[model samples]
Target: MSGLRVIPTRRRGQDLLYVCGTDGRNVAWYDREAARVHLFSEDLRQDVLDALGPFLAGAVTVGPPPVPTAAELVRLALHPDDDLAPNRPGEALLIALDRDPGPAHRLRTDPRRRELAAEQTVGEALDGLEGGGWRTLHSIPLPGGDRVHHLVIGPGGLFAMYALAARRQRVVVTDPLVTTGRREPWPLLRRVRSDAARASYALTAEVRPALVLVEPARLDVTGPPREVRVLTPADVPALARLGGVLKPADVEALYAVARDRRTWGKG
Candidate 1:
């Protein structure tokens, strides 16, 4: 007996079957996307193949893993703490709330919870575009205690997006100001553009600005806000239809840089 077992795992949306020895050490892995069985040790090649025999489909190249791409190398070099790729939709807010949850029984709802819902709703929509060759980083911290709610990179190019919790409220957009229900108008669009500009400077790429309103009952716009695209969660998927701005490699490269916490420090 080979004393080897096949373990399945998923990484970056791809399935991988790892061949492990009795000691639980990975000797090889079968990559379905690449159609290759990568061997860590030439001596165990046959044993690893035998272990993965049942899982193997079609013809697959058998050899050492291919060389890592530039993006892969960058990702591999990142420290886990400094990698922002895994941040959840409302990561910073989640951390803040966890640190000081405040009164367990509140008289009124916490506004942060509303904002968290907006971000998570929008974040999930953006995450769904991954299969179309897009990447999203949530809650990217900028300098001076400010942050970009989400950064999207794909064939449509880069976008620094802000999430607004409008929930059942009517929204009115007048130039720089945004009014939600009866609340006083705020220059939210200005801030959105500024965040995108700062991100552009940091990444040395043109990043468009977007304001995403979550489940607003109605929306009124006096005129199209200059340099900012206002959208709803439903509009996010259409962005995947855009192309010609960046290739797959460029998207991966930009995503690699954007996912590093240090990249935003410059902004």
Candidate 2:
């Protein structure tokens, strides 16, 4: 779309509250849940309020499922950096956010992605890996039957090799975002960082870098780290096509790693 925004959300009473904005306008409001996304337009708020009726009944949950420990979140957030490898889940979260420079965004609640990222399952997000290029490596589950899969790409987009896979399926090229940032309607994930002291100790770090094509449109709430877009199915094809192309050596390497069961471990 023209411009987008994201707000971390939560329900109050029966309505939804979020921070929203477009290229030319923005605001934080507690409106009917439907109004948060479906109700507004560039012009008057007339249909905006009316459009919110259907979504007014419940509240929107914010963020992914909470991890067991703050440290665990730190690990997932800091993972997959160029200099460091995510060796152990227990030790991973100890890394500071500022260490890695790649952009990081969390997946929102949608049935399809949730289905793809089976909550608490080992291989919930394996679908992205089976194809030919970068595929899925791991998945994080949510309250609903949704999941968030992690992908990695090496080299560069047009000329690099990469890997993708569902959490359960053998890593394949079916889901490729590791190299080419081609997914459309992709969610806007906020970046997390850490101070220098922590960064030195963790040996893991990251920055809130923006994706190649994914841009933040608006804010969903008022807070330190913010929430961005909610992804929908409308974006699948572009992402798929971009991932399917076999042009980069990184993509080839990712495919090679995925095809070998010995490399994927139990997953």
Candidate 3:
């Protein structure tokens, strides 16, 4: 007990202090967000508390961890390599940039960097909805070198969202075609719907498609896209206001299935 160490770590933007024994096995962990110290054993309760004395703030709960839910059990059973929960926004691009950063000095900024920024902005917004009973997964890799920028599940139902880096450009949407600034129109909505369809196939559930434009100067929709929902970064939080399509348990179940890398591989 004298050799117990308190190690600090961060997970999902939350601070955690882990109390480890001399053998480096975790005896307890303090979740700052929950203001609780989860103990692995009752016998070591006082020892764990003593080890965390310097870090303890106000009143805090000291007890065994709660029973794992079915979703949590599934998540726990997954191998680290197969877990998609840890992926940050634009994870693939982040990896690629890390592998080859290209010329140190560039004539113009990398388009990938702009795409990454857009994903991060939208990803952070989606992640904020977690407290309101939503679950989001970022940078889900599909077969054929494609990816779903973000997958969101909540009372609003499931949506596969694609982030566009429109920045200060005007965006025009006409069916499957999308035009940004002076750029030529492309069938972007087709890809958005296709990604959603793949997600639906993989999860065996209804997955809607959404296009999120980041910081577009203006958005014009000549005619609403068939089945795709168009939005901007500021509009993401509105999804939390939607309900009746799913229950909390359903959201967790779908999230558990979706976070497995194998789930997308089959699609």
Candidate 4:
């Protein structure tokens, strides 16, 4: 009972258990002390566990799910924000990395966070991009089950960005791709093409994709793919300030499609 305490997840009335097993620490469904660990986002689960430990000691156990209660359990099962609304699938990815880390997922809690952090910084830079001029959506999912890091739209057309946090690491941008000194060349342009096509469908507008190689230090590009622009995190704000404009209808249409929770997947 000590390690398997009944607890409320971020959402109220949606209770799971904090578990300690020989294999590792996790959150799972409990029935008669049985554990069914629902795998979604490991980083999120760990954050929940870290935060839950203190909050649960004094917080209210339940307040019922949100309105349109029919979707309450569905929403909970998929993992929701504190207010019972859906969260980005990438968030769940970070959490899942915490639960069962493979070589790739293992770096999520650390280096990848810098990557995600760079995305966050760009968000701050784009703070003035909203309201009739430009709209951006983060962590967009493709039909093929891949997710785009950032989607931006304006009069200049659409842009989808895939970002990596290199943190001052040595990186070489070879036009259509990137090869780090410490890592293999990442074929980000391929993803850009695929995601741009997907965005064109989602937004009904042709999208140009960009590969953002974020590092705290130096970044340079040599004849990168014509369609995909390679740039550093610092260069984002200027790009964002391009002042492209979209028709009201086009704006609403793309925003609606990108903002839909159904497009985010279960995380």
Per residue, candidate 3 scores C-alpha lDDT tens digits across 47-142 of 999989999989999985544476676555688899999999999989999998889899999999999999999999899999989999999999
Candidate 4 — worst ten consecutive residues by lDDT sum? 59-68
Worst 10 residues of 2 by lDDT: 199-208
Q: lDDT per residue, candidate 4, 1-267, as tens digits? A: 134443433322444453332322333322222223332234345543454454344333221111223343344343233221233324535655578565664634665566557666655554446653677776665555677777777655568877766776777777557776578787766766667656654433356778777564666677647567776666766664464345545554555545665543332
Q: Which of the predicted structures, 2 or 3, would earn the higher TM-score when compared with the native?
A: 3
Model 2, span 77-112: residue lDDT tens: 422332123222112212222354234464544333
lDDT, candidates in the order shown: 0.86, 0.28, 0.87, 0.54
CA RMSD of each candidate after superposition:
17.7, 20.3, 18.1, 18.1
Q: Taking the tens digit of each residue's C-alpha lDDT, what string does model 1 give over 182-220?
A: 999999998998898778756645688999999999999
lDDT value for model 2: 0.28
For model 3, the superposed segments whose C-alpha errors exceed 4 Å read 1-76
Ranking by lDDT: 3, 1, 4, 2
Report the alpha-carbon TM-score of model 2 versus the true structure: 0.23
- For candidate 3, what is the TM-score? 0.72
Best to worst by TM-score, what's the order? Answer: 1, 3, 4, 2
Per-residue lDDT for 192 in model 1? Answer: 95
